[model samples]
Target: MISLARKSILHEWRRFAPAIFAIAFSGILLVIQAALAVGIFSTVAVYIEKSDAELWVGFPGTPSIDQGRYIPNRVESFVRMHPDVARTEPFSWAGGVWRSRPGMGDVSVVLAGIDSRPGSLTFAHAVTPVLRARLAMPGAVLVDIADRDKLGVGIGSSAEINGRKVHVVGFTQGLRGMGSVNIISSLATARYLDPGLQSADEVAYYLVKLRPGADAAKVQQALSPKGSNIRYEAWTAKDFASRTTHYWLFESGMGTAFGLSSLIAVCVAIVITSQTLMAAVAASIREFATLRALGAPTSHLRGVVLQQALWVGVAGLVIAGILSALVLWLAKLAHIPIALSVPVTAGCAFLVLCVAVLSGIAALSQLSKADPAALLR
Candidate 1:
């Protein structure tokens, strides 16, 4: 039965080509779009995801970590006083200009102040002693590697941050969030860049390091907004990242746009796969009727149809996979950030199978109408 199905599809080269193309194109488009969307959102909130602390304390009514009001620096002291909280560090976020070179066009940047402690934002424990030592210099900051071209700076190179002369001490990976390239510097440099945060009453975020076995959700609840003159909102690290992701993915309508695109792709696959398979089977209506009139059981006919579906599914996946690779390679060459997770890959495979099976089922109705009388005619 599989051999017959294979021969059938091979015989109708033109019709099969269109069906396969539809499946391949839709699959490739959907997967790439989904991957890019995930990349953008994950890139946007990567800091919240990678922070060494378990909790984040920010001002109330803030939509995202980058847009939050500058809370007083003393909030770190208050948070540290919590028994479960072993330590609190200030994340001094400030807006600044990044000159590409000593004298060139400038771009906006988010400056985050980080300490050279155990939970340093040194790109996942790779911060070298020399880099930390250099960062401690009076006018040193780290830039994200992704922004190396954007900022046109490297270690030992000089650039202006908010008009303040500075040296790039090191680089971190994936720290450049969605909005702008990030310039991570020490607390001193952040204050130097933004004089408004010089007062003890102003800070951006408080990253809370809890004791071993501490309950993160409990700590978050404990720090919830209490209606104080200086309001505060607390979030667990995961929740904090989620909040940012939600804002960009849902509130910003990115998820909706991507989802709609995927839906349209699915629809295209179903329509083309169903119609083409139905027509292919129609071309053999008399042959199918003769088989039914002979000793071949109805189940055998069904198996042949399913086998045809399986052929389309497996071949379509191969074509889609190849096309997807081309798209990914081009994106990489262009320095476009696209991430394809295991789930997305698996989902694409599953969707391909669904396209095959669903089309097979829809064509089942057409196959049922194959008349044994046509064999005599």
Candidate 2:
């Protein structure tokens, strides 16, 4: 049955091209939009996702990691007491005003205080060992390569954070923040830059690394202090990352915009795909009628049409994959944050197939024109 369908498509390639293109276009839109959406929201949790910490300890009721407040510095000692914990590191977050170049005014920036020790947990994925070594120098900071122009600074360029002089020692890739430029520096520098907010006795959060083979969830639960004296909360790394992404994605109302745009993409794809498939079916009505006249089952004819749709979908998906790859490559070169995880890519493929099947079902009504007597006309 599929071979017959393939033969039909191959024989009249021009007639089926539009339907295939429509499906491919739809697939590209869905996949690219999904990548952008995930990428944008993922920035909100970069601190969590890019780190090697197994658990995050922060103030109770912290809405998101970016909004973290100072929890007692003593919380580090409490977390370190856990048998599964290998180490705990203090992390600091505070808003700062970046003094840009002459024409550019002050820019809002986030001061990220991370340990510059050899194997710091924070930003372990994005920050290299060499950059960590540079950060160990006082008044040295790191900026995302993507944010250099926005903050009006480059490698070795001097700038001021909260009126304190600092120089960009290096640049990190894929460390851009959602709202503010991120200026990464050592823990002591962060405290020096924002002494009022980041004091010696307090830190915005604590990053916890567990011993090998320790279950993060179990350790997170065990470290979470119970009762009223609980001034802080502990979350497994995955859970904390999800929490931060969810806050920006759903709670912040951006998800609605993304959802609406995706719906529109699907609707457009379905409309165009169904119309093109209907036209193709209409063009082949006489062939269908001849098959029916030859005693072919109506069910068999329907199956052929459905199989054709499936083939179109497969072709379209392959094309879309190629196109999406090219687009992503270009986006990377342009320093755009767009990511496609395995699940997201798979979901898009499933959606494309569903659209193709639905278009085929809609085109099935055109089969009614396949009247045996129509051949006489």
Best by TM-score: 2
Score candidate 1 by lDDT.
0.79
Q: For each candidate, what is the lDDT?
A: 0.79, 0.90
Q: Candidate 2 — which residues are off by over 4 angstroms?
A: 195-198
Shift in Å, residue 328, candidate 2: 0.8
State every prediction's TM-score relative to the real structure: 0.85, 0.94
Q: What is the lDDT of residue 213 in candidate 1?
A: 98
- Model 2 TM-score relative to the real fold: 0.94
Q: Candidate 1: misplaced stretches above 4 Å?
A: 1-17, 101-104, 117-129, 195-201, 225-230, 295-303, 322-335, 362-369, 373-377
Instruction: Put down candidate 1 lDDT per residue, 82-117, tens digits, no spaces.
Output: 899987777777888887565568899888777755
